[model samples]
Target: MTATALTMLNCHLTIPALYFRGINDMYVRHSRIQHGVGQGSFHSATVEFSATGRHRFDYVFDCGALKYAKLSPEFQYALKRVSLTKRAPGGNKAVLDLMVLSHFDADHMNGAQSLVKRYAVDRIVLPYLGVEELALIIASQADAIDKDTLKELHGLANGVGKLWKRPVTMVKTGPRKTEERVFSDDPQREPPDAERSEPPRTQEFPHPVSVVLESTGAAPGTVMLDEDNLVVGSSSAGRHDTWKLRFWNRGLHATLGEPGIWQDFERHYKRELPQTQTVVVPHHGAAPNAGARFYNPGLNHRPRVNAVISYAVRNSHGHPHPSVLADIAYAGGRLLRVTDDTRLGYQEIYLFRP
Candidate 1:
């Protein structure tokens, strides 16, 4: 938590977990992983951020702190709700650390728009080039953005003007090796609520206690399990302060061939550490994010990755291609989908300060 400790971490180390509200949803499943990883260190303070009043496609990402920020309908609703919760004292939810736009598609941008309009974001992160550059999102004749959207873009553009000084990258790195310890917990539903005088409002982050720490500190695959520790609610895993990944859609050959693309994320990661824990899968787990040739894990030393997509089940453009899923398995990473728990609203989490 000091400047010295901060120097040892990866950039991705601090994103508490995030989830989404699935309407016409595809399997983005990001929340599921966060739900799993979060365990019990931080309360997954999440809400249905999307409102019927907003535009259809946009989804936003906010930490109630300013590491990085973006706008979208889903995000806008989340912030409106988060603002009401009175965020934890100093979680950096307000600091503009990084920014990302999956694609230039209006729905995606709508969420970006909302973030730009609301927060003092420092950077903007996006795939190598958004669909707008491909002449698909802004100029697509079949699904061109409408007047209302254009107006939102105008506001977003104006907002972005102030962020010229902030760093933007396709890959983000954050604090270093996080230490983990287990805590007490219960299985199934209903955790014994910690005795807080008031209902948790805003992100009840920086949890005070309740760990189930125990390590044989021995050989591999041989460790004891604490019955009191709820794996779902335990804060035992350690995280590197810093992390790294390449953000591109599909084929590694194409990605590797495109040196400029890697330059962005690489430069960004090197700005701090050598690697990252999570890399936003470039194309929402699509073929473009993978390659025909096998990916060499030894050579790659890939980070803990999970695909983050905001598509619904019946979306015209199918998501989470079979190949992408295989790639994650090959890479030993997890596939997180937003649609996995539409019934749960938005899945939320908090990254601990190691």
Candidate 2:
């Protein structure tokens, strides 16, 4: 009878130095707009991640997309995530669940109006536009904030659009055209190669999760959203079902296109698949949709998989790239970089560690 427990809430990521906060308003308006309205037409940007409290998470990056010219502070780092509604142990968060704001810049919606002053949100997934082009990019960032932070970023985007008023599955995770699988020893063709030939099955699209909450519930009301699409840290009842919990987050490469984002992540990894051994990587390690590969050709011959990078470490973009960590270490996977020890940070919990 041995059971150990330790739960901490604080998964943050922030990077607010984008070209030194807009490089002195662009060289002091470059000579008052040198000849008129100029200074390279303003491009000052920043913002990476945030949740701040009630589980914690924050990040915002900027430094001229970095080619290098002064970036110390250990190149900025932070991580911590563990809390997805009630109890403990992975799996479940799909009451239509999703929170993907993949691209819209600003390091991906940094402090995104603190998600309506901070969580309780239902749905807000996005890949592109629909609602008047996302309200003209939130009215050009409320004309560069300042009317009381643009009235508190429009009253926190209208209380996070009424808890992200469910129904924003504007899916988009394209870039399908990746066909390169061959591992056969051919005993004379058709079906005699049992030691090889296992990488030819693809086609499943529609991933646009920014926020979802429709769980009516066998278990996902406290917010553990299930049906398999994991988001853990704390959730129980004795934990261990829904096949060891699962979660994905790499949708929208450019928007409902690009071969339809690899046919919507090959149909959610071919219907709730990912033999749980722990997983987490989808854009935080950056690399466009491939966002740090996690290839698992059914673990053909098994015994390998070490991916858990959530980004933060000299992140002037060059994110976890080493060719996306050498293509997830050439498919056997093994990257692990939640900033690789920020003294303690990286919480997206739910590990009853069965």
Candidate 3:
């Protein structure tokens, strides 16, 4: 169906988003952190995908770490203040349809375990890159972490799999690209290749759950946008059409051999990409993630897109990079920052109507 048709369904959809403020610390420096105070770009969003009101999807993207602490009281309080729970049918705690970890950076995944413990997460999504490969990439970057924190982050990543009994899906892009595969029970063991995968372990949820992966193709170096399935139906059980909602994560830096995020995304999913109205600003609005080329209206244009950048107040690195902000404005998109100055703490960006 056309986006115009979807606009007719806008009254039937409500998108509520919560962006958390990261604890600021002066010590660590990495490309992910534009300024001295690193940003915790934690986002929890809920999408009511079906008109039946039976197909609601909740997702958490990159649970950011609290400053100087693993489970900081401030962070916990924020979670509670937001009423983030797994309770069914009315408890404020959201029953997550999916939990996505963009990369292995501590800032990206530090609070993952806390989320698992607090919410009913049905699936976890990881990049196609292996843990070791991701770890090495972080090591090569500037402002590399010490051995202890690295170990701790790795441990926490592993813990998410162990703590959640549901499926863990890993996604990658390229010619060797594979369909989303659900991992076996053992979190430590290597999962079988996607082509040779087995059935996922059974999950008993209060509602039906579906995960959708939008990829360019099986070509080498493609981009895959992963998220919960988006369905269009006048009623929840009526004939449904599926759509995509892309969440861009700054996973790897561009190298001589690697394609840039937007480049790969454009090459593979350009037709579908433009249809996306909402996007999470990559790398907490870092410059590299929002290069001019990505937002150039003439080249890669998205008409009337809403871009959300999660930044901390008074962060060391001035985020929502000035240039990126200009580019976003140039593309005719509204820019929303998660910090208090902007829209923070349980705000509704889109509401469904009949």
Candidate 4:
């Protein structure tokens, strides 16, 4: 082995080094908080992780608004930026790893149909509703929103209708407890004909990504979401980091004025609230949805929370209520209002492993 032979070996070694760059650091590249029009909501985040190899998981929470006939600008822009498939090999149809539709409000999900058409979503997460709850949602908003949106809501209540092309997780809340159940629209997955003896068809992306609920003392478990359990902290794992997101959605029947929702939320963490880097203000910062419990950083110290309020400039509901704004300020949260206007631009938050 001479000097030339050694130099040739080093050149080959550097080729593999290019592929392993940043392979150890698992972090969120950035989250795009969409400035939706007329009280819509769209927030997406890209997480880079290493499993067998480096991979990226993209997820979106709520994409739509109260646009009458046409799709909103922000939602359109979001679609433009979102990739058509998962950021890995095989070229699967699934675009997002997870899609969370908080509730059935028109403003929050008016463009859902468009989303379904544009991207093949992997799994959708929404609150589970009974007949009464579904009826309340339809009857309550019958006159306020368009009929198409109402029809779509009706479809989701029954079985996610056209959107049923993908998998779904329905989160049901009980007395101070929450349960999640998985439902599949694909007959191969959950065959409609139970009597059939044939095996299910093979899936391009067979294994779906799961939300792991974590607690202080307990190790997180991958949720099949088919059992009775209380999942407080939902997290997605990277190679060296685990990112957590806590969603607080007061059920349609829950009283908004009081703090029961917050109480139930806190109880999950054993009364010790963890440090939340970002908090999406619920209901576009509607007054009823805002409570002091949401702002508390608790014993675990944290930097300024990013309080994101997605609403329109002149919304009929007057969202981002003065009190909600004030409460966020008092809690030392960095108020980041996301409206239809481009003034605030895309509020991108970068997350790194602690």
lDDT of each: 0.29, 0.28, 0.42, 0.47
Which has the higher TM-score value, candidate number 1 or candidate number 3?
Answer: 3
Candidate that beats the other on lDDT, 2 or 3, i.e. the better one:
3
lDDT by residue for model 3 (61-151), tens? 5665445534334345445543333445325556766676666566666667767767777666566454665467566632535555455
**Candidate number achieving the greatest lDDT relative to the actual structure:** 4
Encode model 1's per-residue lDDT on 185-242: one tens digit a residue: 1112232333212242323332211111112111111111211111111122111111
Cα lDDT for residue 29, candidate 1: 16
| Candidate 2 lDDT (Cα, 0 to 1) | 0.28
Relative to the unseen true structure, what is the C-alpha lDDT of residue 248 in candidate 2, on a scale of 0 to 100? 27
Model 3: residues with Cα > 4 Å off, grouped in runs: 1-38, 49-53, 65-74, 81-94, 131-134, 137-166, 176-206, 212-251, 255-261, 288-304, 340-346, 349-354
Clashing pairs in 4: none
Model 3 lDDT, full chain set: 0.42
Off-target runs (Cα >4 Å) in candidate 2 are 1-123, 126-214, 217-281, 284-316, 333-354
Residues 1-354 of candidate 4: C-alpha lDDT, one tens digit per residue? 000000000000000000011224333343454554556776565555433233455667666766554456766776676653543322554466666676666666667667766666766666665567678876765665566655655676676553446555565543443432222212123211321232322242222233333222132222212122222111222212333333333456443334664455445333124433455565667664443322232311244756667777876676767876776776677777777775333456454432
lDDT of 1 at 255: 38
Best candidate, TM-score: 4
Q: Candidate 1 — worst ten consecutive residues by lDDT sum?
A: 2-11
Write the residue-wise lDDT of candidate 2 on 1-354 in tens digits: 111221100111110001101111111000000000000001111111111111211111111111132221222221112122311111233121234343343433433333323334344434333345446556665443335443433433343322233333332222333322122212123321321233321221111111112121122322221122222211111111111122223422222123444354335344223333333443444444543243223321123554555444544556655655665566776555545224233223222211
